[model samples]
Target: MNDRGNASARLIAPLATLATVLLSIAGAAPLRAQGGAPPFDVPAWAFPTAPPPRPGTVPVVPDSVTRHTVPNSTRHYTRKQVGNAFDIPDWFPRQHPPMPAPVQYGVRPEGRACGFCHLPDGQGRPENGTLAGLPVEYTVRQLRAMREGTRGSANPAASPNPMIAVARGFSDDEVRIAARYYARLQLTRRNIVREVAQVPTTRVAGLLYALDGTGREPIDGRLLEVPESIERHDLRDPWVRYTTYVPTGSLTRGRRLATQGPAGPTTSCGACHGPQLLGTGDVPPIAGRAPSNILRQLINFRTRARRDSTAASMYPVVDSLTIHDMVALAAYVGSLPPSRTPRK
Candidate 1:
């Protein structure tokens, strides 16, 4: 009986040892298949990896940093430095190379790369004026004004002139190109219902006429009442003049006031801006622009907020505008269709 029990014990111990060895081999099989590397293999050389770059230690500069020295050796001129070293380019003769082709904005070809901000559509935001379907000639003239500092906001105190800065970057041909692109786009028709409620009481010229239940009212003497429901529609006004949203009648009235002096003022608009209010070589076109924008500018002139060398020329003209006249003039200018330079 003792010998049988001992034999059973020895057999059980050997079987247990065999099972343990099998289990270990099964576990080791995956490691062998995985090339015997640790789960996260640390390279033998990198094992004690320099204690993770002592906090905030200056990083080792790569050798590529030395490439910047090549430009220093060549001494290439920066824009300002070049201008300072060389004479100013000639204004009339071929002093500079022809400008590069303009960047296209959608179907429209922006002569001056209008896509930088206005995007493919001329529906620019409040920061910049919309240029879709505007008169090409007017757009060019305004760009000229901005570049030459002849036409701009009446406010002089505003430190940086955004329009002026933009204009300064464009050449004459570039302005023409951009203007032409915008002039061809379909104009957006806005259902403008004049809002009488928003109109300042001080600015109201006459008794309100018809008040639409929608809050717009027409005032006497052609003054557009505010609160007009200006729904942004996709249609363009066929009667608009070059690069401008103003109507012909409004432009005619503005012309009369600008040139012949309506009511009280003496000189004509042509005396400063050319005939047809098309603008002189340097002056900007006033025939077609946003009425609201124009009104704001005229007010700025009245308030002495804006200033320019040309302000003296407009002082007498603007000084004569009664609140009604100002409104009428703005409306007139805004109503004219945009004009364009005929393609040669």
Candidate 2:
């Protein structure tokens, strides 16, 4: 074989091995099911977990199709009818990016609306990526990656990564419209990261961490972060914000890694993410994103699950990160207030 073929083989060998291991592990150990058990059961070395729900009444899963409704035109529309939470008051615009029918409704019997998970505001949940404020090129590239099978979740059992399946079904025009709409929206700080010795009781409601009641418990070295109110979040109320709790000093340690790169496996984040770490030319801003998401992305890079050209840039940094190091890095990066422009 030629040198290029050899190089490709080298990369593919380990990834294929890893995939086999993952499939084996998944078959042996299933992730905790929703409601039955905690929803987020990622390897501590790879991803963070939400604190266990406090014992009490089962936390209400926001599943009432009729209850989750919003006004559209002159009548109220159910979540299913709207295809997304776009109609939620105080959150979405009446008509954003003049969404094409494909974006507002599904392409047909199979394709789901883009806004279903991304929301009309484009601020996605921890389970998915935040699309708002991304550069159009960057968004397009990711969609293409999904279509081409280069980008995917490292932990499929933990996160099915619905986008991969969805993207595969999208036409080019649908991809363009969805990308443009999300790109046009602004990226803002909708969440804060806090380190705590103990966290409030939380339950896994679908892909969200929700408070089960008004009580706190030792996190036992685990991290738990979620929106204060699941109801408000479902409404897509922009005023609704999220709070993430981590072990104390994780942020401080993470700041050191981010700003100094103590051991030299990686350089200071400012080198790439800009002085303030908001973002650079094509690099999307990571400052205000969810810590879980950041940690997940880092893990994906390490495992080669996200092997797009841009993700390749992260391999060196993440490969050297220990789980604790990842936790610290995510905590610190997530703590920084989001900035859109470079410092003057």
Candidate 3:
């Protein structure tokens, strides 16, 4: 291996063991979950388990006969066209570079189009993490981990995890293509994050929360991530905005936990995620992502569900965090603006 490669390898080994000895000395108390599970337990709000799809929720409509339109969108798509997973919804294709075949259209047969759920812009929704401006190498590694079963949800048995099936279906070349496409896709905007004590009542609407007209209720110390307009979001409008209502004082607590740590300075998130929590080298940036996704990853790391090499390095840092701590960290990090410049 080249000298630089050797240096890089040397650098990585220590990170996996980062703050381990010091953290062991700290010996944090076990945090209890709402259901009396471990500290890393999946919080209901962050990973809001969607109800099972009703048998007749979606009414049958003629594909070509029905026309669908979203706000500010001049283009129209038929019911069949929108339902076709192979044909992604690109509401504003001019805003981004042309997506590679793998991104614009999924690898045939088993693979689903990359843009379908993530959106054509790669901005993604609250259920998944952002893909835009990600390091290609890092994204590739993550995809590989999913394919090999090394990456997974902290709680998987309860809900369907599509990434595993999707990753398994992707050819390595296709993975690279999609990763490169998303990497080159610049971040256009940040999701709206607000810390509130009370939030609008919500209903489970297809793996995401949608505000119910039943009036406001206490946030109850969890993140309430919902789309500004569920109808627009369902239309796969890449420009659709989401409002994540975090617990009161979550941002301040999260910022403190990220910078100062629970006890003292030890492998702070910024150390690997960059000074502004953007990212460093092949490490994925955490800022401006969905707080739900961030919390899910933190739970995955702490629970040892995502066992990829880089995630192993997150053990010490994530282990120190409780659900509340992770919530604060995710809220603060998610509220920040993403890095505008590309990193090599």
Candidate 4:
């Protein structure tokens, strides 16, 4: 098995009892704010909120103390060291290949390392795009798209653009270096799709959500994806898997939509991406990626937030879709396995 192996099977929660379709219907409302005269309605749930304010007082940890460690980690770092925004904490460097300058330590002042958000393994979190096993050419194109004005967030008010800043700041050589390194690394499955009527209450932690397990709320048609353990997540564990709680029956409905467009409103995803949704050629794999990440891309394309030539085909596809339709498609797509090849 690959040294990191994937998260254990138990990490993915199974779908609980199904809820009526009525719950999914409730989220059909459009976005309250408009970035432009969007061709399609934007859904608020697709955007992540800003992280909660940090406590004014953080318990001091002296440098004399031994470095802190996470379970099974050989690397150790002090709290101050681990929180460095310019350098990524590669808790398990052996888990993947070596990182380049842009991947490990980005340019000071303006650029942030790709690994800081995409993680060392490139599985990525709900907040950013995944780079693992992506096409080298495609990756470069995306970086160019971000550097130029072709790609951007549909909801800029939700959070500032980290990718855009990095794209604009980094030199072209550094961009190519980061792209090739991550492109060679295989992407493991880290998303666990589950359908449930209720989900544990959660709070925004950084760009993603973390469930508290103490409270519960009705799953009224939105996907709630959070790390299995916030403690492990806080450690920046690359092996951490996320469980996405989607409204009941979203998966089944999504499967039909992906395989067949029903009428002519949407196109079958398999038509462009491979039948497995693992992508083909320049198209990147969608299987087992973050659902929120997927949902946002769909929304962005429809809203013209991403107008690159690559996304041209998706504009019409997402244009005719509703909020619930997008949710189901994201849920079903996230449920698929990213790859079957074992790593070591």
Q: For each candidate, what TM-score against the reference?
A: 0.38, 0.74, 0.83, 0.82
In model 4, which regions exceed 4 Å deviation?
A: 1-39, 51-66, 262-266, 342-344
Once fitted onto the true fold, the runs of candidate 2 whose alpha carbons sit more than 4 angstroms away are 1-79, 82-91, 94-97, 262-266, 341-344
C-alpha lDDT (0 to 100) for residue 155 of candidate 2: 60
Task: Please write out the lDDT profile of model 1 over residues 1-344, one tens digit for every residue.
Answer: 01112112221211224433443343211101111211221111101011235788997553422221111133332333222211211121131123223423211221234543443345332224466656677677666755554454322222134455556666778677766666565434321323132322212111111122343222223333222211111011112212222222454556566556653544665565555554565555554444555565665454333344444555556655665566667665555543444211
Query: lDDT tens digits, residues 238-294, model 2?
Result: 446788778888988898888886447356777777787777788887887778788
lDDT, candidates in the order shown: 0.39, 0.63, 0.71, 0.72
Q: Least accurate stretch of 10 residues (summed lDDT) in model 3?
A: 1-10
**Relative to the unseen true structure, what is the C-alpha lDDT of residue 341 in candidate 1, on a scale of 0 to 100?**
46
Q: Give a tens-digit lDDT track for model 3, residues 1-344.
A: 11111112221111323223332232311111211123433444455555466887986664777788987788888767776778777777777888888887897776898888787778887776688879999989998887765665554322236676777779888988999889877665547789888788888776677887787877767776788888887878777788888888899999989897664666688877888887889988788788878888887777665777777678778767777898898899888877666321
Residue pairs in candidate 4 whose N, alpha carbon or C atoms collide under 3 angstroms: 2-343, 2-344
Better of 1 and 3 by TM-score: 3
Better of 1 and 2 by TM-score: 2
Error of 1 at 332 (Å): 2.6
Order of the predicted models by lDDT, top scorer first: 4, 3, 2, 1
